[model samples]
Target: MPRFAGKTHTAGHIFFYEEMVVIGAIFGTIFSVFYPFFQFYKWIGNSPVWETVYIILGQLFLCLYGFFAGIFVGCLALAIAEMLNSIPIFARRTKFRHGIGVVILFMALGKSVGSFIYFLKQLFVCGGM
Candidate 1:
């Protein structure tokens, strides 16, 4: 028997890819973006000695120049995840869609640089670094 369901506007197949993209984003955001911060908070909430460690890490890891650095990372994570979600749809349409990924990568790079600069400023001013 021939494979009846492949492409050409099949609702179920399209939905599957869309769902795949969304799920990938959710997983990526949770694992890459939030896990470290959550672990830090849990650490701080539990121990006294670790509180010092937490603050130091917060200064070094979570802040830049002197401001909260987590926001930039989180935003970049979200942007990358969304771009990944777009991949499934774009891949099916045109070879040029590959270029979309490059664009997304540049966006992510921009986010990273901006976040790093912002945090570096915080590190200097707030003594977080």
Candidate 2:
């Protein structure tokens, strides 16, 4: 089956539709696995059995939060990128439409950079690293 639905009339009109959300969530979970901070490790350390369960649940909850946050930030960045692409200079460029793959590349790159900055800022602010 086709991944994208609906019609397209202009550049920046293409979207992942609802697919990006699901994809983002999957990526977020994958991201969580690689995330460096072990925020719950101390809390879970040599704990009572019940506390271990609670800590595990808490970690799961944080992972879920990260997942949703990733989707939210990605969608926001995409919307911002689309707005930039709508500017007359960009909109009028033939390559802008012809190279839709480039648009996706830039959008993903933008999102990655923005997320990294956010992660670093959070780490600094939380004094955890």
Candidate 3:
């Protein structure tokens, strides 16, 4: 069998990195593309060719923006992890870096959710146009 096929080591790091990248990409793309699309589509409806054009153009921008956003966030987390790993207090635990990264991610996600909730409340309760 191949050496890495059986997962001798480094599996956790690999999984953690993959998860971070996926999450970053999703959040970035959603932020840049879907949020605006939905906001405008509510007013414009789904009948116009211009709407289609807007979405296509938006996706082009969002894809590139999302790709880089994901990379940047992932890199930042990795840097934080490295910094944490260097501290003597956390040297004993191998997963400490991942834990710190996850905590930071959750904090950011929680803040985003709060904003989304507020947006929904305003849109629905205030009778948005």
Candidate 4:
């Protein structure tokens, strides 16, 4: 079992990581499937006294969520790249001799800029969300 960080680790640690990922996927699937049945949104909207507090807390929660979500996505991408040996193959195909780090940095920058434009422009809202 390969670790996401490319570090040498014991089998137990690898199993633990796999278990956590599976558990997260299972819970996420369940939540999405039953989202309509969850009344937290309604409760929040109905509570006038706690509305401000809820909004502040909700924003904080979203910030934390976004931070961890970014980490998870970055780690997942790295793991996939390692698994497929994509960098080496890409370099060979392009006859590139060096500056792989620069290529990766540019890719990340592109993604960041695209994401900023997408959310700043509320493109997702136009998708019927």
Candidate 5:
């Protein structure tokens, strides 16, 4: 809903911005508060107190980092999407910006897919720690 850098944002940009902020907050909360949940991936067989402390710290750090990351993500995602759509600057058109957007989109998609796969691996993998 905020104006960014003198440019009026489209609806998609606003949506992504909101999404990133929500995601960052959620992840931050999850990481900081439930850090020990990660132990499910690999129980270090260490003291429970230490694990609890680490989980709290991790969540705190994650929440703060996520807050910051959300702001950047909103801006960058919009910029990338716009460039991909070929909204040009300068009288002389450069093809580079347009192509760069495509690359960014694919990279984002790939990472997202990879992250989902990794999450499943951690979730459904057999055997005990």
Candidate 6:
């Protein structure tokens, strides 16, 4: 959260940012706890109109969720990398003196490819896709 605020140059509003983060966490927790109880799919399944609306809205929600989730993960990964100074350390260890940019690019691409595979294979679920 601090990383997000810092990246946006909104460090001065740290309190507001912290409050928003807390509120989001609370809402997320509540949603997770009550999600099965809601059974939205069961309720909407009978109505063609409602089902179409739900599908469209759900896709839009997922797109937005994915966008923010990507931002958070990217920020987290970069923050950890920067904190450890891993890139420079690795470069020095390998006697590499140039193309740090190339290394960073490959690292990012690797992360993207790995994440894509994880989701494509549905590895998050209990059973394999």
Most accurate candidate by TM-score: 6
Q: Per-residue lDDT for 15-128 in model 2, tens only?
A: 554566578778868767766654555555755886878778989999998997896788677777667767546646654546665776797799899889878679756646
Which residue pairs does candidate 5 place in steric collision? Answer: 28-63, 31-59, 32-59, 32-60
Q: How far out, in Å, is residue 127 in model 5?
A: 25
lDDT of 5: 0.70
Ranking by lDDT: 6, 4, 5, 3, 2, 1
Over the full model, what C-alpha lDDT does candidate 2 score relative to the true structure? 0.67
Residue 116, model 6, lDDT: 98
**Model 6 spans with C-alpha error above 4 angstroms:** 1-4, 41-45, 86-129
Q: Which stretches of candidate 3 lie over 4 Å from their true place?
A: 1-38, 89-129
Please give each candidate's TM-score: 0.28, 0.33, 0.33, 0.53, 0.32, 0.58
Per-residue lDDT over 25-126 for candidate 6, one digit per residue giving the tens place of the 0 to 100 score: 998888877788667878557688888888899999999999989978987888877855877888899999999889788877998998999988888874
Model 5 lDDT tens row, 1-129: 355623654655777767876997898789867877866526655677778978898999899879978977997898777665654452136645446557666878998998787776775454222
Question: Which residues of candidate 5, in runs, are more than 4 Å off?
Answer: 1-45, 81-129
Whose TM-score is higher: candidate 1's or candidate 3's? Answer: 3
Number of backbone-clashing residue pairs for each candidate, in the order shown: 14, 0, 0, 0, 4, 0
> Residue 58: error of model 6 in Å?
0.6
Q: Which residue pairs overlap in candidate 3's backbone? A: none
Output the number of the lDDT-best candidate.
Answer: 6
Model 4, 1-129: lDDT tens per residue?
Answer: 375424654655777878887998998898877877764767557676677777888999899989989988897887767845788788989999899889888888998998998898888876433
Better of 1 and 5 by lDDT: 5
- On TM-score, the stronger of 1 and 5 is 5
Cα miss at 77, model 5 (Å)? 2.6
Candidate 1, residue 38: how far the Cα is off, in Å: 24
Two-way lDDT contest, 2 vs 5, winner: 5
lDDT of 3: 0.69
